[model samples]
Target chain A: MTDTTQAAPASTRDRLLDTAAELFYRDGIGVGVEVLCRAAGVSKRSMYQLFGSKDEVVAASLERRLPASEAFLLPPADDDRPPRARILHVFERLEVMTAEADFRGCPFVAAAVEVKSPEHPASLVARRAKNALTAFFQGEAERGGARDAALLARQLTVVFDGCGARAVVQAQPLDGLAVVTAAALLDGAGMRS
Target chain B: MTDTTQAAPASTRDRLLDTAAELFYRDGIGVGVEVLCRAAGVSKRSMYQLFGSKDEVVAASLERRLPASEAFLLPPADDDRPPRARILHVFERLEVMTAEADFRGCPFVAAAVEVKSPEHPASLVARRAKNALTAFFQGEAERGGARDAALLARQLTVVFDGCGARAVVQAQPLDGLAVVTAAALLDGAGMRS
Candidate 1:
């Protein structure tokens, strides 16, 4: 549907990245460059020209997903929800995501895990993505006067990632488990309203 | 080294399973059969004879690891520690494990996520492994007289898993974060030693 004639390079880049994200998420990071290019409908020559290596594609795909991923999990910018609710909002979204049949796990975490090399480019991107969530939590914790904002943020991130793993391994709905766990942590930290 | 002279079939099976567990854990599930057989000193035909397929190898490798994995993570059989201590012991071991250079999160979790299929033989093995951990937690929770033993056990499993994820993504030592978070949840649930 894209007007390939206008800004063709950018359009091609977008197409490749979109495909990469989906393929990698569904099929682990082991997906080869040949398969990736064929699936994206982009020629191997063009893909190589746009990205230096398949690793670059992996990193870029995850990087491109960061904004939308945060948007989906985090509350709206203008919404003045309480810090507790804002924090809980992430888990509520995650619970719904886990209910979907195709939900594998957090793509970022998956990339990091599959790569097995923490120093890999995709792992770095995944780390930043996870850190961004932790930072968001820390900011809210500070605003809400949590006893240890940094620790609370880290704890919340752990719960979020843990819930994702549980959903994948169990292949079962979390029901209200994620929300309840997050709320318990919020309460334990005395983060009321 | 396995003595191939005695009970060669069983020895071959042991060698293949051990190598498969290490290779699959270090590398992702995408390691080709050729590479796996080469590393294990196994012939492709021999591997097929021992296990019906690569999927079976993955499942059996994980199955072979269950006892050692549980022993590594859980308290000793004769451990007379109270319920709370028994539960926390798992996190302690996890923190230690995460500090290793080659730690790639929980093998079961990594397998389940990498496969992206809940019904895959390996994924089933992963689910059973994770459930065993949860069952261990549940038993301890009940013994501790927690208000909601099932929920507490679930929460504890989440914390344990999340801690693994945090360590993997950040590539940093937990430094007691897992223990603290687990303890906080225990306190919140009124699970006293």
Candidate 2:
């Protein structure tokens, strides 16, 4: 309570959300309000003013990462690659992400699993994020003329998540496992280039 | 420290680990030492005496669950099913487990993700547990005559984990996604019955 709140509301909000996302990903979701505020360099009062509670902050922060997550994981808007390549591109990116020393699997999955309560706001955001990935996969599957786009999409998503989990549990990069698994799914679905 | 260490040491350890598994699975690994001890009805002093640290408790609890985890997830002993059936049986079990209201994904995967530090004792135990699953898959793949047993085993593991992640994020049962994906992979690998 003693700390002064000098930063403007907008900047303060951005800073808090950024810090929240980073800390929550690095550590577990159990990080306390004091620790989060301290890491963000924001006062407790300012955090409360912007976010109703830490749970809201967790949800909002995950929401904020969605656009960037899709942008990077999904193919570029102007890219001319076929549906199959476009879909495989996502897994390729995942393989690269997993190679990083700090990689800890999909943040969305991590958050939802750690939150435990599926009804929690953060878990809701996580579900939405996961669904978006599935939607992307389904769209690609359809464009590629797969026999059953919906099933193919779900299959691809399962592979995506499974690869992420493997990386985390094995504490090793996927190398090309992501790409190979996705390719197998695409092949099985008869999703042509 | 005030609470007396009343129970015998062996029973006390069992009670503590059992409670730890239940609470940690229901909640997350972040459950504090005091809360865990209180739930187990063991004094803090007694818990410390038995387990060197909370981390050890987490690891040992997970280690204790391994036998049952394998027994349930793996095909039953003395079953005469073929390799494909044995492999699909695991996913069938996973589908059933995910249907439970209390399902929270694989405890080992959850623990590894929550711990963040791969070197953590709990993470190591989780890795060992996951590896056992992969080994079982590998054995079945070899028996079934997979084109490449190692790769097929890895793919199956990825699908298993991906389905688990899907269940946790969606907060809904997989509804056969697990079995279908594993079957697809088995087909792609050309693993004969």
Candidate 3:
């Protein structure tokens, strides 16, 4: 027999995370704890025993996803491209993600919209991620010599949000990328040669 | 008491619509039918008898809010300003909306994210409304002699979507409007005087 049977506890945690991600992504965070437990094939007791509450599960899922996104959004220290090129690279990465068959918009933005209460742990985590993005954009814009770095950073963030929503809503990934690139160029981030 | 009793049916429908909108906007469309019925003070049989399904209630609620948005998006002819001015006017109106106390992103965009299937009737209606906005944008861009009207229209739509999401998520309406205006300028649409 294969060794798959031996790792039940880890597998259960993975399953719970995967199920929570799907439900939170597709149905929003308001989905009940019992529903998540049933979908994950774990008992409600196991879920609470492992993660305490739905909010903790959400936080764990976000913590798992955020690092991957940060890796994609932040330009590498050794990267030699100009600030403008780095900005375009971020949008290019977005395009590739949205092109996937199961793309469902930015998970962070979705969480933010669903959690109305700012005091919620999930909301606080999401806000931290969002603020980090804004700061990253602002730093990049400053390096790019934008006269109004704050304004430009804010505009770029808007483009990021807009592109994600447009890709999902229009069901066209390339169209959203085209808009992102056009917006970047318009904002004076000249296209790479 | 004599006339009040006769106005019950219309009032009930209005109450249901209002309650559904609140729940749908806050909790999402996946909220159970029973929860909606209980929240609205209507019996399950009455909910089904009147609206057919939860989907129909969502559709009707969206339709109820559509006219206000449509009117803002497609304002009556104003010979006083050029087409570009009129186009930018739409964003200004949206800015006012975001500034409202109860502003919670664009309901259509939020609903679209919740409803996974693109072919759902409510999704279709939201899509049609979005398409109409794009077409309206294209007409204005064409009138301004843009080289690529379709592209500009798509770009503008993304800006609107992004700004609305940011406004709701950040609870900063002015920030959203600022991004919108910046996007308009970047798209080569001259600032309204």
What do the candidate models score in CA lDDT, each in turn?
A: 0.93, 0.93, 0.73
Cα shift from native, residue A34, model 1 (Å): 1.4
State which candidate has the highest TM-score: 1
Better of 1 and 3 by TM-score: 1
Question: TM-scores of all models?
Answer: 0.97, 0.96, 0.85
Give per-residue CA lDDT, model 3, range B1-193, as digits (tens): 8678867877888788888888887766767888988999988887777887788898787767787788865668654676676777778777887887777678887777767656666776677778888898888777777667777777777778877777866776764454454444535543233
lDDT of 1 by residue, A92-145 (tens): 999998999889999999999999998899999999999999999999999999
Candidate 2 per-residue lDDT, tens place, B120-177, comes to 9999999999888999999999999999999999999999999999999999999999
Candidate 2 structure, TM-score to reference: 0.96
Candidate with more favorable, higher TM-score: 1 or 2: 1
lDDT of 1 by residue, B1-193 (tens): 4565667888889999999999999998898999999999989999999889999999999899999989999999899999999998999999999999889989999999999898899999999998899999999999999889899999999998999999999999899999999999999999979
Taking the tens digit of each residue's C-alpha lDDT, what string does model 3 give over A16-127? 9888888887767777888988999999888888887788899777766788788976678798887677766677778887888777788888776766555667766776
| Chain A TM-score of each candidate structure, as shown | 0.96, 0.95, 0.79
lDDT preference between candidates 1 and 3, better one: 1
Badly placed stretches (over 4 Å) of model 1 are A1-6, B1-6
Fnat, model 1, is: 0.90
